[model samples]
Target chain A: MAILNIEPNIAQPDDFYEALIDMHRDLDAEQSRMANAHLILLLANHVGDEAVLREAMQRARALVPTSSDVSTRPA
Target chain B: MANVDREYQGLAFDYVRSPDQDARVAVRHPVVVVGAGPVGLTAAIDLARRGVPVVVLDDDHKLSVGSRAICFAKRTLEIWDRLDCGDQMVEKGVSWNVGRVFFQDERVYSFDLLPDSGHRRPAFINLQQYYCEGYLHERTAVLPAVDLRWRNRVTGVTPDAEGVTLAIDTPDGPYALRADHVIACDGSRSAVRSLMGLESKGRVFRDRFLIADVRMKADFPAERWFWFDPPFHPNQSVLLHRQPDNVWRIDFQLGWDADPDLERQPERVRPRIRALLGEDAEFEFEWISVYTFACLRMERFRHGRVIFAGDSAHGVSPFGARGANSGVQDADNLAWKLALVLAGKAPDRLLDTYGTEREYAADENILNSTRATDFITPKSDESRVFRDAVLRLAKDHPFARRLVNSGRLSTPATLHGSALNTPDAEAFGGAMVPGSPMTDAPGTMRGHPAWLLSCTGDVFTAILFAGDRGFDEATIAAIRALGTDGIPVKVLIVTAAGATVPSVDGIDYFADDDGAVAARLDARPGTCYLLRPDQHVCARWRTFDADRVRAAVARATCND
Candidate 1:
């Protein structure tokens, strides 16, 4: 069995999304990035399992294109 | 149609001069309530019914101008039933139970507010706020102890340790009055609140909405329809509701940059209505106004001896219709305690519970309305994206349906974790726990049909459930011997056996042949629930114990 389960788990998904949006309401770009970093660190600490954290990071990174690939590709 | 139009102008209650205005000093009254709107009139009538004299003051001589607060919830109807005006409201209002939601042009999900049968009132009724005020005003006129004075504006309120003194301005002249307690039910722009230098603090949404009451003959079903980002109006919301006398209330959401004055003109408003109701809709405008709402409330509802109720105490966005409904409930929670305190039966500390409990309720209303408002009007682009995603997903998945927020309709706030509750000693199974309003069930009282809620009088009531075996002689005698301590406790015995018990003095019997009451209350053979004057459960037991009941009553009244 997997240690991390992330398949539509929240009882009130909209409330979580709302709170997340509200958290970033008044922040600038730098502040928003810092807030995201802090939030990730806090959530990672709560996850505790190193393997699960590594898997989450890999899954999150796979969704975005690499900077070098985007630079070399045509617009 | 003429009568409805005339009510908009208001039947003038001519300004009458009271002898108190000519007194040497400020004439002292027992209780003085400010404002003649639904909340104030409710408080006055409730107090007068309890045999406490109340003087109600209002700045205006007629009903309010527009049809504000069109939705009256079932809980409000129940409170009106206790106050003797529910029949009139139910008769004149348009009752509805079904509500539909639409994302873009396609229907998302529909809901039945009252899925269960056997309820006395429908889930909600759409009536003009003026009609509610008229019914409450008619009820107040018959109550001898309620002195409702029109055009009596309270300009100044001074509160000392003993009581509150007011400076009133009437058409005849100004007058000074004093009262043991003052209940302020003034509207959101409360002069009394400003006089005290207090303010309500909350987040104010930047968008404005146009409320138009259009008179037309149409065949739309009497159901609440809400649309989000429809083709008629893109990137906004629209709400359609049915009122009495062929009047339909349509609310069109305008962005923050829309001009309020420009939007009220017929040229602008007519096109919007025609856009939603087609070119040949044939409708005449009954009323129109542009309003911006905020979710805020006073820090405390009570300041010394002056208590604020209604919009003066708290306010919410119009999405949930929680404003006037919760205000009337504030009066319901307050009147009995004030009556008891005035009669010297309970200590003054009991009145403090009203402030705390209602403040807790106000916080809940603010939170819910704020959430609904946030969903309806997203502050950020990301938030709007999330909201649209929820609406889109709601059309397919059941889990996402719970995320849709089209104003959770108003329901009675359960006063859980109140200071007045007696902690339970035994395990209970249902929702009728301490500090919860008792659920209503259809039953028969002495061979006549009645509601279980109507059987509870406006006093401390002990609802005894006779499951299989009837009550013992000792318990019945103890119930008969109650109230020697000056605070009366009325007894209502509920039996599911469908047979009458032996008649005893000071005890009423209810036949629950369908056993619905038993199932709703989770009652057992010897269970007893102690209800406050407001019909909230303060204590309960699996077995009948008169001593425990007395202790709970004492705690409920803040005597122990």
Candidate 2:
């Protein structure tokens, strides 16, 4: 196992998290969703645990309601 | 009647006896963009400025009504300058340099937009979306390379391997159009996106919001005024912002319980606004609407020949003004790439990178908006209490003040796995290196401001320190060879007493205290950092000469 530790400096977790939230709110819906997934992936990569990532993905997927009849159109 | 007949004859169309239906109108353009909104118009203008021929199609008979996005960030204005419309936008837009945040009934925090250095843009400008659209429309029309078609709607879009075929309904009649590529900038409910069957994935908040643009007379200071808890209403309150035209854009979070229809009543809205103002302020409503939006993004932005841009790709809560700005950025990202591909300067694989890069940016925005929404309207009771406590602490603690001042409410875009990222070396320890800004600096990268290499001699070199063993001659020669003519090259290797060995000479070397190196590089030993053009790190590697570094840089610089 490889461990990567990012120290607290100018870009702290609080600051990073808050910045992420702010950017997320500012984006449109399409960009926001992709941004959410990207953040999860980036943070997951930071944590670096496949099992944890799998669990988080499962939890996130569960949080989203399954709409079978919903159209999968691009809009 | 005879004089009128003479005048009408000049403007009248001559009717032919018989015409063949097989006659074709020939107009071949490199790219044909549909929808002349901010995204489409920006794309056209960017492509046209790049000397690429573009034809824009819009169904709108006239300019759009109402001001959609009134808050423009500093970065957005900078982009407008690139399009040569910054001065006009700034002149007509309201400047907001200061803002205050309220918690419960008290002012929890206040901050200024002026940072120490490095930001070349202002804090924010509040301009009407219509004005932005109109400005771009006017500029795009004058360009000979750009053909603007108003009152024309794309009725059907069909894409094949060769190109895209569009069925357009003009005021004249339905016409068939063909182009190499079609960029869909038709807002959130994009017809092209719908035709392609792409799904937008995300959460829709249950809470409803009412945005009212009103012209009112008040003694309020010219600052972004926010109320967490109005005395009359206990829950999350209103956000009042002054626009350019003496109109105040007020946003109220009317929870799922409120009646949206009744809330629209001027009688009900007037008193609530008066309560906050503490006086009978006369005002006329410009526009009012109750909207419930979900933070959703398309599963994919491109499907074969059709590419989605702006709201067609993603939608987020407008808490931090990221919605419109990000869309404009989408155009910025796509325009350059498309121009390169059309000019045969880069491979088609570069197009695939649009998804990788913009998706990362989109995700960042989503997280920021979600957190803001949660903070503004905490879901759980405990979370609300904690947030309130944090807000109170922000008043006294410097750390809290810094946190509040940084506008953590909006996340900056980070390029991780994009065309601009380079592979990391083992010594870098999988951390991102600093890149140069996108100014006319001697060594700045062309596309994005993210990437680590800075121009030294004839080649761009990544600065590195030896935590492992130091660089060898062969790798140094390779770095030199890679440094083609007109490209500067220099390698500086720094070795610390207890540092590990570095495996590559492509990086500039230096010898210093491990602490000092860590502070400068913002990383530890055995780490390879990838810097962007803006002196920001895009990616990093823990071990020296990681495989992904070269590939990332190659993708970024059109080398691959």
* Candidate with best DockQ: 1
lDDT of 2 by residue, B291-352 (tens): 78778899788776788888889988877777888888777777767876787756776677
lDDT tens digits by residue: candidate 1, B1-560: 25754554467888999999999999999999999999999999989999999999999899876679999999889889999999999999999999999989899998898997767899999998888898899899899999999999998999988878899998888999999999989989988899999998788889999999999998889999999998899999999999998899999999899999999998899989989989988999889999999999999998878899999999999998899999999999999999999999898888899999999999999999999999999998767766777787678766567778999889888889998999989999988989888888888887798898888858889888875556678877888877554787877889875565666666798888788888988887788999998899999999888888889988999988
TM-score of chain B of 1: 0.98
**Estimated TM-score per prediction?**
0.89, 0.67
Model 2 chain B weakest 10-residue run by lDDT: B436-445
Clash pairs for candidate 1 = none
Off by over 4 Å in 2: A1-75, B1-28, B117-119, B398-412, B423-554
Clash total of candidate 1: 0
Give fnat, all candidates. 0.00, 0.00
